[model samples]
Target: MKADVMPKPQNMFQAYMLLFLISSGQIGVGIFGFQRIVGMHSDHDAWISVIVAGIVSHIVVGLMFWILSKHESADLYGIHQHLFGRWIGNGLSMVMMVYYVMVSVTIVRTYIELIQSWIFPTFPTWVLSMTLLLLAWYGITGGIRLIAGLSTISFFVILFFIGTLYISPIKYASWSHLLPIGETSPWAIMKGTISMGLTISGFESIFYIYPYIKDKSNGAKYAQYSLLFSNIIYLFMMIMGIVYFSKGQLTRSIWASTSMLKIVKFPFLERLEYIASSVWMFVVIPGLMIYIWVLGRGFKRMMGWKQRMMTPIICFVIFIGSLISQDREHIHMLSTFTGRCALFVVFLYPVVLFLFQTLILGIRDQSDKKGAAE
Candidate 1:
């Protein structure tokens, strides 16, 4: 998004806060749970799946940024309407809105479930969900620019806490288990990459914020770097998860990365994972906030509503949706289902949009040639 949408950054770094903010959103609660899930399908070579996910994510993110740069000023809702025409575009916009709202709900359910299983076993999810909804609503009301600015600090804190992964917990890594990488079929990696696709849906930021880009010409480059950077982070996390947890350990475990930290001891504390995770709340917060904001943006443009009223309205809806998950099992089912659904928008939509737009571009070019000849 253009830097002008919320605060006009005085410097280029401030402007690039959008990049960091978007990246931060991409690095949310999912990272905690992903290792266990990836290990299920890919084994210790699951690290390879993350690398695969990074490549696919980079291509999809690149496509999204390219689409945004082409238009220069319009958001995804606008692009949908432009590409599909009024009725079809508006319908697609509605689907996209539902798609985004589903994402916010997924984040809420994921966060609350994480808290319940790992930390606050007695906490009521409704209260937890409502609390997160309200906090995110506050950020949204403040505007995307604030979220953009806050992302830098949030990411730094997230990184600071993540430093624990480099410690003795890593000694748990068994090299022999991972010796035969790609021992699995090509189809296994491809199928498992689908789930990893769910883990990397943060690229939606470009669609929502294209209007705020400071220089449209460099939008693609900035987005490209963001993809590369996120890939590195994800791959590292995956490798750590595989090395520390082992394939058998990861296959059966939930929140394997965070759980692995439970064994980590410090001179000062024993339950280091709890301490590390206490701060991760901030990391996931921005992600939930930005997604809610993105959904609201799509709705506002589609329906001509004001941001002020729309932000709280969507937060309420997401909070209610999150309350529906009765237990960890239900939340797990929802995550699996939604992860499958998001595959379409995250990986397939860009390809579809690119084909649609490419045809449009070709026709326009042909028209120009004919006009020149005439």
Candidate 2:
């Protein structure tokens, strides 16, 4: 099959929008409760783990860009077909498509769980699941430019939420809570970094969206900047969680970031956490749309399916997946599975693929030269 074609100029977005797309994608449901998971591994030094994960994400994204740069206007699907022949390549691409679908399910279900747990105990999981999926379907159908626009809006919504964090949470933080930070063992910090894979995984979406970037040269630069921005936000939140709650409390607080917002009070508006939880849909939907869009797009490329036909099918699958996994134990299981898969898919696979591609190209080049000489 021909390599993936370049998107028309009207469909392309600025390289700068990548900053929003990548940043918003990384800062979804994972941020709300990631502190507890990271804290369980690294204790107060969880901030270090966050930094390490962020650096590794930067490296993985660099590898992805390098791979794409070696090919002309190709996305991940095209790269796969080029690296592995069509049969093996389609198999791997299908695996990635399934993974993206799981990611969408995880994001939507986790958000629904948060809403039901925090705001309305009796709310129907299917209702919220269908609602979010419908919103995602609308955005996905609008196309990449609309998806990018949603991400841009999500970025500022994140900023607004971040600004709210300082208002109340900062006042309660205990500076000495983070004392002797490096006391956590290196092994523990590494474990924490591994646990961080899921939270930081969305940066890999760059692989699929790279072909749609208007300025190819600036893609890597802006993508790196986006990762840096996400890292700063995560590090800040990690430190806040460390200081705002006691060690025991921090480990137990599932939604530590949202929990921190509970103290923000306005005379006219009480229960700010409830408001934050509701408004967070704006942040979550864009990331969800991006994943679903990529999943649909991958199928379209690999099987010659229409994205419009695949979009609803993908969303319906995710919606059913969300409804079936409503309880905490099942949600935790799904999240853990996704996280483990992400460690390989988002981090390890790119480096391995890049090296394998380089070796293959080297052997091919040598064979071409030998044949020419003969």
Candidate 3:
């Protein structure tokens, strides 16, 4: 199965780091305006969609660990090979590599778009792209341990920024806007659940990071906590968005989370959204670092390429791609495509794997018992 090609286990991350890493990954780009998109279909009942999606995410995380628990030391590539044989498995792994790369690109570019639209209309895209990519490049080269530490930083820093919502957005909210909930049809709520699925897709990073956990048995628990935390944050933000903006205003605002900052005027400070925007870089950086690192790690696993070399090249490609995709429409298309792809990769794929593994084990156990009886 070419398992020997996988790097020898080195120092591993602790259980807590799993919480930080998974949370950091899931909480990015999507959280800002996820309410609007999900709301478009489900409307005020969108928070219901968030809750349902969170439950689904918890289930998916459990299934991921079920699969990983069966093959304790293997990553997704190894699991694929075990289930599908060498050629098909490697091909699937290749596709995952491409998905990871696209994730990194979409995230970095979207953040860049946010910057250009909100804070710096005249700023050159390439400059911001290059600068962010360089920082990500440096972090990825330090390997997963450094990346985990970065996630820890992102988690705490983001909390303070999240606290800002309490100051302004909550005051503007009308709880009546969220009333008449459950008024949406089941089909509509399910559609919103699907949208929330995309927003919460980053938990799939666990597939790549699983083998590195120091306490493998506790891995699933920490992952569930991470997903739980993300769900809470997402739900809170979506509710705030619903109440603060009228139905029309909520749907129209692209970055509703940041838009909440406009009401956050202080005696000494003005343009609080700008302050929130600046702090968002911290929130965004961890996701970019982890996804980019995953892309590099995927290359290392499949082709035996050095992650150090692969990272900068991937970053360069993302930079050039960002430069080319300055149009808002183009950026939106990229995000939509990535979101759809992630729904399959992150949510559905693991369930299929877990079922296949369970069936195979059952059949093998029957054969063994029959042989022993003979």
Winner by TM-score: 2
For model 3, the superposed segments whose C-alpha errors exceed 4 Å read: 1-10, 361-374
lDDT of candidate 1 over 1-374, digit per residue (tens): 12123325542233356557767878888888888887777776777788888888888877776776666467777877777777888888788778778888888888877788778899998998888888888887878777876777777876676664556766777667677878987777776777787688777777776666666667767676766777777887888887776567777777877887887787888887776666777888888888888877766677768878888999889988988878778888988887887898778988899888889877888999999999
Q: Which numbered prediction scores highest in lDDT against the true structure? A: 2
Q: Tell me which of candidates 2 and 3 scores higher on lDDT.
A: 2
Worst 10 residues of 1 by lDDT: 1-10
**In candidate 2, what are the lDDT values of residues 258-320, reduced to their tens digit?**
889888888998888898889989889989998998998888888889999999999999998
Candidate 3 per-residue C-alpha lDDT over 56-116 given as tens digits, one digit per residue, 9 for 90 to 100:
9999898988888776577887777777778888898888878887888888888888888
lDDT of 3 at 54: 92
Clashing pairs in 3: none
The whole-model lDDT of each prediction reads 0.77, 0.90, 0.83
Backbone N/Cα/C clashes per model: 8, 0, 0
After the best TM-score superposition of candidate 1, give how far the Cα of residue 124 lies from its true spot, in angstroms: 0.6
Give candidate 1's whole-model lDDT.
0.77
What lDDT, from 0 to 1, does candidate 3 have? 0.83
- Model 2 ranges off by over 4 Å: none
